[model samples]
Target: MLVFWNARLVFLSVPKTGTTAIEGAFAPHADMVISHPPELKHAPLYRYNRFFRPMFERACKVEDMETLAVMREPISWLASWYRYRQRNFMQGHPNSTHNVSFDEFVNAYMRGDKPAFANVGSQAKFLEPRPNGTRINHLFRYEDQSRLLNFLQDRIKQKVSLERRNASPRTQLDLSPETLKKYQRKFSAEFDLYNSIS
Candidate 1:
């Protein structure tokens, strides 16, 4: 996450949404950057509200920071996770996708108790609004990099260039039509949320 205190903006890093690249591009200009420790780097809306929000509001006396986050298309996002876990080093890890097919991984994800390989968190859940009404002020689609870049440049008044970073390994990923339909139906929020965003 990158916080631009002067601009009253915080960029929430959603996993697999090109946030690493975004963080790298803006870290130099950010007032505070939480780039270490994956948990903090990808703190969801609830975590932010629970921890960081209080810090800003009570300690810093800043309560009006706007939050920004990116959401990738659901299937593509899952594909990234599948490929990421397939890395050689992940071979014997509980979350490894070493010998799993995309369909099997996704199917496991739909279960009440997901296997580690298919337990990647949901994008919609990550950005869900809190009971107190805290929510993302600006949400961009991962596929729409130009819009995000323009918004950042306009807000920060600087040139920003992002390099491709932490890309998952290549894989031939295709889910069966039935499985795709099931996934869309079961986790409609992810699709609905992405579609709602311009």
Candidate 2:
């Protein structure tokens, strides 16, 4: 996550949404950057509200720091996670997807108790609004990088250029229609949230 203190803006890093690339581009201007420890790097809206919000509110006496986050098309986001776990380094890891078919991967993800390989967290849950009405002030679709960059540039007053980083391996992830239907049904919240982000 990146916070531009003067701009009163926070960029919540949603995993697998090109956040590494975005951070590479925007970190220079951010007053505070939580880039270490994956949990903190990808802290969701609720975590931010629970932790960072209090820090800013009490220590900095800033109560109006607005947030921004990017959400990817749900299926594509899952595919990225699938491919990521298939990397060469994950060869013997329990969470590796090296031998799993994409259809099997999706089915595993739909399980009430997901298998290690398909346990990636949902973008919808990550960006859900807190009960106190704390929410991302600017949310953009990951597929639309230009709009996101433009907004950040205008707000942070910085020239931006995104370098390719943290890319997943190239893999064919053609889901069968039956599996696709089931996935769409089971994980509709993810699709709903992404579609709602216009």
Candidate 3:
């Protein structure tokens, strides 16, 4: 997460949403950058509200810090995770996807008892609105890089440049139509959230 205190902005890092590239580009200019401990680095909304928000509200006396987040299209996001877990370094691990087909991986994801490989958390849940009205003020589609970058540049008053970092190994992701339909039916919330981000 990148917090620009002067800009009254906090950029929440959603997993598999190209946050590494953004962090690389903006870390130098950010007032506070949390990049250690994966749990802390990729903090979701509830976590932010519970841990970080109080500090800002009480100590900084900043009650209106706007939050920013990027969300990828649902299936595309899953494909990224599937491919990411297939990386060579993940081989032999319980969460590795090296042996599973994209369809199998997704099937596991839909299971109530998901295997480690398909246990990636939901994007929708990560960005849910809080009861106190602290919600994402600037939500961008990861597929649209221009708008996200433009917003960052204008807000930070610095030219932006990005280089891909922590990209997963390349793999063709193909899901059977039946599996796709089942997934969509089971996880409509994911689609609903992504579609609502216009």
Candidate 4:
């Protein structure tokens, strides 16, 4: 999607899902790169984070770059994200916010209330045509990563291979009948979109 748009690819890093590894791999290939702002510098970073801000606006105007992101299934993604944060961010706090289990997290995600799950960009928005009727040229599935990379190579005329750097921590979950219905309802559009494209 980024290469296709000829705009600087923004990972829009959601928790876990190997964002760091992906950024590391793509940095050399990118003309410009941005990563998570350091803890102390986060406030300052946000002041300058807008793509339309002066520092980036001129560059954006001159360079035809593409912004791209990846997404995963919400239930699986949220479960892994929760575990990743519990290990990395919630270390030794007096009160911990990481007690939720996979099933609990999935319930919240299905309701679109979890921050990690909410952070992934909207596929419907990404796929919708612009006012000028231009649609994003590509949107790839993490499940179909090899094909996505192959398609990118074909577009750029360059050979690139990506290694799988991370996998979901919760490998198994028992979904109740009610929970299954919630997931289907919550992600109906995405499921439809995937089927149409596939």
Using all chains and alpha carbons, the TM-scores for the candidates as numbered come to: 0.98, 0.98, 0.98, 0.62
Per residue, candidate 2 scores C-alpha lDDT tens digits across 46-100 of 9999999999999999998999999999889989999999999999999999889
lDDT tens readout by residue for model 4, 1-198: 012234343333334435555555655665545553532111121223433233444754533333334445555554555555455445555322256555665576665455553243444434444453333335566566677567656655566656666553443455677877787787787667655555
Model 3 over residues 161-184: C-alpha lDDT tens digits?
999999988897889999999999
> How many backbone clashes does every candidate have?
0, 0, 0, 7
Where model 2 places Cα greater than 4 Å from the true spot, the runs are none
Clashing pairs in 2: none
For model 2, the run of ten residues with the poorest summed lDDT: 189-198
Candidate 4 Cα deviation (angstroms), residue 46:
16
lDDT per model, in order? 0.94, 0.93, 0.94, 0.48
**Which consecutive 10 residues in model 3 have the weakest lDDT in total?**
129-138
Shift in Å, residue 180, candidate 3: 0.6
lDDT per residue for candidate 1 within 1-198, as digits (tens), equals 999998899999999999989988999999999988989999999999999999999999998999999999999999999999999989899999988999999999999899878999999999999999999999999999999999998898889898999988899897999999999999999999999997
Runs in model 4 deviating more than 4 A are 1-18, 38-68, 91-98, 112-135, 166-172
